[model samples]
Target: MQKSYEEILEEFSENLKVLRKKQGLSQEFVAGIELSVRNYQKIEAAISTPSLRTILIIADGLGIHPRELFDIPSLKNRPMVKEITTRNRKSAKKKTTKK
Candidate 1:
């Protein structure tokens, strides 16, 4: 079955948000670089469909390759492991020290 245009746009928007977050940037920051706060927000919210040139501009502002924006993965739904604690590290060091 073919996907609807809205669905495709939504997915693209989601991927854009993920890429922006991965680059440690806020919408305000991206807007500053792109020179339009409203435009950035509209793209992120999927309220307005972005042109290919606009997508490329956004990707450039976010310091990512344009191809990265459309490379969304389905297996990223798994929970990520949090950082290790100092106590956990100490325990691990002790185990390794004895072995």
Candidate 2:
């Protein structure tokens, strides 16, 4: 089954929090550098969808690769990752069958 947009947003928010805490950075520290406290709070709370540019700024503030924000290690066994992994395996099976 596919995840709803809201579900994905929730996952993203959880991922954000996990990564931030893992690095021992407070929300204030994260916001103080490049983003506003309110905006960062909203994003982390899953209350808003950030633009691509905002994502870039966030990744920079987190001192991580931008893609890491999307593919979180803590969420590797979560719904989104499971769904994607299942889909990829299905695709690979199809390719092999067609060969």
Candidate 3:
């Protein structure tokens, strides 16, 4: 079945939030890609839909392919992505602290 528009938006928001946090980045940093902090916040909050250009800029800022932002296979997919992101963040923190 096709996902609803709202579902896609919500998934995108969750994915963006997880990806940003996993990189230990601030909203301001992602906002600098091509938008204001308020706009970026709206995007992550699912309050506003982003244009393809904005998505590309965000993907570039996050250092990931744009496709990753929309790769949800199912509703259950988000939690798995979030779990991996959390683990990656923890591992990165450990590496940083070790230095």
Candidate 4:
């Protein structure tokens, strides 16, 4: 059977864990520079998907490009765009506001 999106995310998360550990960085250290402990744990636990910013943060923490997080060979075939801007967040929030 083909893998679902969740499955692909799980693989990405696992790859990140191995990469982070290989760099000898603890989760706490990564969380400090990247994301909250709860959020980081969720990424590892596959409870919540990571955003582009989170991926960039993790990549920076690991001293690698964000694209390296993907383990699937196919994923590398396409360009991964990691766009993180405060404007996007604000626009998303604005969409939910009562007119």
Candidate 5:
């Protein structure tokens, strides 16, 4: 089976918090440089998903590569991780096939 959208976001959010805390950085300190506190909090809360640029900025703020943000081993396999990405597969295929 495939993963659902919500599951992915929830995992990403959890990963973000874990990575941040593991580095001993404060949310305020990280947000002050490239993002607003509210926005960072929202991402950590899984209430909002960050764009590619935001992800890069966040990774930079954390002193790690962007890919490290998604270093969760559980994010792989199972038709794209658990079942959070299944419904979007059709739409994603459409984008690649259209052009």
Candidate 6:
């Protein structure tokens, strides 16, 4: 299923946080790359959507490919996504059992 814009943003936020933590970097450091700390906080919190340019800037600061920020395994398999899939499967099972 196609993810909603909000979902995509949420995924990006979570992924960015994880990646930044993995690199042992602080928000202040990441934000120093062409963004104010408040703006970076908004992006990381999913309170604001970032443009492609901003994404690239952040990736550059993190020393990673911009695509890596969005296409990470953790983002793709987020807990909410898995939970929804599990619920759908259970509902389908119930329907089949009813028939």
Q: Highest TM-score: which candidate?
A: 5
Query: What lDDT score belongs to each candidate, Candidate 1 first?
Result: 0.76, 0.85, 0.87, 0.77, 0.83, 0.87
Once fitted onto the true fold, the runs of candidate 1 whose alpha carbons sit more than 4 angstroms away are 73-99
Global CA lDDT of candidate 2, please? 0.85
Residue 68: error of model 3 in Å?
0.8
Residue range 1-99, candidate 6, lDDT tens digits: 557778878988999999999999999898774898999999999999998888988998898989888784445666787899999999999999998
Estimate the TM-score for candidate 3: 0.69
Instruction: Name the regions of candidate 3 deviating beyond 4 angstroms.
Output: 75-99
Worst 10 residues of 5 by lDDT: 73-82
Model 6 collision count: 0
Q: What is the lDDT of residue 42 in candidate 2?
A: 99
TM, every model: 0.65, 0.70, 0.69, 0.68, 0.73, 0.69
Candidate 6 residue-wise lDDT at 4: 72
Clashing residue pairs found in predicted model 2:
none
Candidate 4's error at 56, in angstroms? 0.7
Query: Per-residue alpha-carbon lDDT of model 2 for 23-66, expressed as tens digits?
Result: 99998887766689999999999999989988888888889988
| Per-residue alpha-carbon lDDT of candidate 4 for residues 1-51, written as tens digits (9 for 90 to 100) | 356678788888888788888888888787775489889989977888988
Per model, state how many residue pairs clash: 0, 0, 0, 0, 8, 0
Better of 3 and 4 by TM-score: 3
The digit string of per-residue lDDT tens for model 5 on 1-99 reads 455777778888899999999989988876766799999999999999999988988888888888878876456665433355666787799999999
Over 1-78, each residue of candidate 1 has an lDDT whose tens digit, in order, gives 445668767888898898889889888877665558888889888898878888778877888788877775432332
Which of the predicted structures, 4 or 5, would earn the higher lDDT when compared with the native?
Answer: 5
